[model samples]
Target: MYALKEREMIFVFTGPHGAGRKTVAEMSGSTLGMKQVISYTTRPPKATEVDGQDYHFISPAQFVAAQADNEFIEVSTVNEHLYGIKSADIELMFQQSGSIYLILNRFGAQTLKKLYGEHVVQIFIYADRATLEERMRESGDSEELIAKYLSHYEDEMAYRDQCDHVFENVDLAHTVFDLTKTLDQNLNRNLLDLD
Candidate 1:
């Protein structure tokens, strides 16, 4: 667990599908004093997912209206479903003393980095192809869906080099430890360099 005395810092986590970015983000936010901003999606909620916890579920019509109104900070469509992060949601998360962790796709992360510039600390999470395939299979996804994800994986991998940190999440425990250490050092540096 991290010492709560550390100042807040916005962390952006991105990765390929089934890379466990959301799980790692939630764990990191709980360990550190930060808020995990649950994104909104037009897709139906999964069996284990809870509204307002995993995501803010919305209808396609509502999502389209929001997009037209420019309510989303970043939005993207994947596999025919739309997902978005709202600007107001981010503002609310950062309102307190704690940091905000935004778990998004590469396109969303790029949009946020363009918007926030140096205020964002981007982390790319990754796993071996076999591990990712096994994970997707365990999740009960169809072969067609898995193949689609595998096709898009390379594009997301290309974005990894642009991140401030690349976390290979094959071993969750060790990855979390390394992530915490890296975050601590980065936070301390940012604090000391505060103007």
Candidate 2:
């Protein structure tokens, strides 16, 4: 694919688990016609997930082989599963489209920010603890997993202050609408800068 002539934005969506970060990222990709940065995960796919769409599901052995070969820009273990973003994949995405969005944890967000500087826009989405728990349960997460996520709530929340934008995700439609507006303004500004 040909690269976009003008740089637009790389949106990194992150928040505590169950905060609707992935949902917002997915919505933005579909609603705004943005390219998605899909990561590789060792975790088994959920009933609603599709390989290469939500994530590239691989075996633990495959994950380790890729890691040993330095295939990832950032890697993290969550719930005993390996997750990583390949450096080549991200570079290719940037080359193909100026507008790209990804769902990431705080560590991945920080790594991308360090690598890309001003080109990366970090957005933190969060909701109340009760709402988080409800959402997790509704999504069919195990009770143990939900408990574990809640245990690290404070740690995850602390990263919000470091983000470029933070928004409560209690209302999905409103949040997405606001996010799209933010992206549009940023895109317009960046396009103008190219001239």
Candidate 3:
């Protein structure tokens, strides 16, 4: 894929868990040639998740060491699990591709926007609460975890209006198409000359 602008913008895809943020961001990166910053995690891999592809699964000690080394740009903890996007990962993406994309939670998303200023484009993936819970259930989330997720909907929407764009992930095909097209229109599109 060709690049559109000289001043590349980083894409920050964010929303609550089960909102398909990772799926959509991966699709965008694959199809648009936008590089994504791989994050490191202390959590165990899920069924379909690949080791290097999904996350750099490491130990808590390793994670803390990396944090101390200033290896990550943003970091967060959920329960006993730790997650962070390495600063080197972002720098490498910018070196390879003009733009970059990464998935994050609402807090991380806001942090990225504030850090990058105009260079960041935040897209909030939103779905109905019921749909979110159902998706989580289908993904093998425990009832307890699903309940935990469901209770956070209100807090998630507290800053929804601050995002540059918001959309539902009901239909993957439609949502991807719409989101990509909108991004091209609002961003640089000279690289993607597809008709």
Candidate 4:
């Protein structure tokens, strides 16, 4: 556990579908000891995904009920499914670890950056359209679903310049190494500034 006196850092990984944002976030978060903030989703879990780990899978009714109660700090709809980050979950994660990682869309990342100001670090990861399409196909996404996601590719990529850091995820190992190194340098700089 981190000391209460230490400043909290919120790392937001934003990218279009099939950009490997979640994978990179998981690798870098694990390497840097940052807690992963699992989000709630109405979408069904993938075969390789675990409940409560990859996402808090819930029904549409449950999602609507939680939204009615203002439980989420950020929410977005993707491919006809709702996804959200519960405000309570963020608080709990902060208590457990000073630094945290979140896999969110561009809009959600913007919301968090607005809320946390400088504490929020936005990282954009991207791949070429052909690579993204190939990745989605390999991940078992339907052709129709891939088309829907790809339709917004340009819009999503527009936010890349807004991020604090941007990475091209050509090689997973190299991308993870670079992400971890960047975070380490930021952490060190923040520590000195805070002191």
Candidate 5:
């Protein structure tokens, strides 16, 4: 296993679909001086989403070629669609000063944790079933899909123990403040603090 140097920190944000991962990522990136790492997806862009900004929308053939070339740091299938984070994008971000944050799903987070180990600061965002359902409803998700998501909520919650931080995103402003404080305290401590 490769041990992490004190200077390196990789922040990972993960949660269920309606739990506000992307929103938190955007807000946190703006506040933390960290760039939001855009991921590639085979799924078509949503009506409100812009190409490259929301995701690097690509054809399945292109995705497969990238995978074959070992270009992705992590990849996974979600709701019958494929998503991946390019390895070069992460490496390039780390090449700059300050920390890098990647917003990903549980499977991708687990894969990155295995690859990066101590260099990573994994965070799991969560909310109660009612809160999640309400958020999903507001997003216009179908009841059947919301029910399916709720059915898997318990299993998802169980994975929280695997993360370095488990944040309850009940209040967006408060949660962002709390997360910023935690990152500053844990990852921005003095050099000797790692000892």
Candidate 6:
């Protein structure tokens, strides 16, 4: 519940799991004066994640009800956990901050791009397979879950061609800097092109 402001663009960061998409999105959003759309999930919070701020952690029934009500802009199941963005949350983010940054899987990103057209800027983040496997292990993902993620690697790579920008998230600081610069340029370009 926030007052309406100027409409804002939507930035969707998509890539393989453990590629630091969320980290880069958080850095970019905070540095650029934009807000992030805290998604809704049926999964429990990680040790470091705050409840309402990071995601609206909910029960399976609650998530299913929302889905039935068509509350989500996009939804995807990963490792048996459901992740989605609520339309209400998005509207609130736009009202409060004029723009939103979000992390999503390849399918979710593509859905958002198709739905929002020019208002959506898609960025694909990836890392070497070895790095990805190591990060996933460090993040506590099980062997099965890691395998599931690996299965999606080909699709994630193919979707990169559809994105507006792509980067390998090797160095966090460098990735943040590069993403910030590219985002600033695109936002400025959009502003000037709005004849």
What lDDT tens digits, residue by residue, belong to model 1 across residues 1-195? 122233556789999988888888877767666788788999888777899998999999999999899988789998899999987777677676457888888888998788777777999999978889999999888899899898889899999999999999988877877787687676663323222
Best by lDDT: 4
Candidate 2: list runs displaced more than 4 Å: 1-8, 189-195
Better of 4 and 5 by TM-score: 4
lDDT string, candidate 2, 1-195, tens digits:
122344757899999998988888888667667789899999999888999988999999999999999988889888788899987787687777768888998888998888777878999999989999999899898898899889878988999999999999989998987887777777773322221
Cα lDDT listed for each candidate: 0.83, 0.85, 0.81, 0.89, 0.80, 0.85
Clashing pairs in 6: none
RMSD of each: 5.9, 4.3, 3.7, 4.4, 4.3, 4.5
lDDT of 5: 0.80
Reference-based lDDT, residue 25, model 2: 81
Ranking by TM-score: 4, 3, 2, 1, 6, 5
Top TM-score prediction, candidate number: 4
Model 3 CA deviation exceeding 4 Å by range: 1-6, 190-195
* TM-score winner between candidates 3 and 5: 3
Residue 115 CA displacement from its true place in model 2, Å = 1.1
Q: How many backbone clashes does candidate 6 have?
A: 0
What TM-score, over all chains together, does every model reach?
0.89, 0.89, 0.90, 0.92, 0.87, 0.88
Q: Give per-residue CA lDDT, model 4, range 19-121, as digits (tens).
A: 9999999999988889988999999998889999889999999999999999988889988899999878888899888788899999899988887788889
* Deviation (Å) of 23 in candidate 2: 1.7
Residue pairs with backbone atoms closer than 3 Å in model 2 (clashes): none
For each predicted model, how many residue pairs clash, with residues at least 3 apart or on different chains? 0, 0, 0, 0, 0, 0
Local accuracy of candidate 5 as per-residue lDDT tens digits, 1-195 = 223456867788987767877787678667667776788999887666899888999999999999999888689987778999987887677667357888887888899888887778888898888899999888877798788778778877888899998888989997887787677766664223322
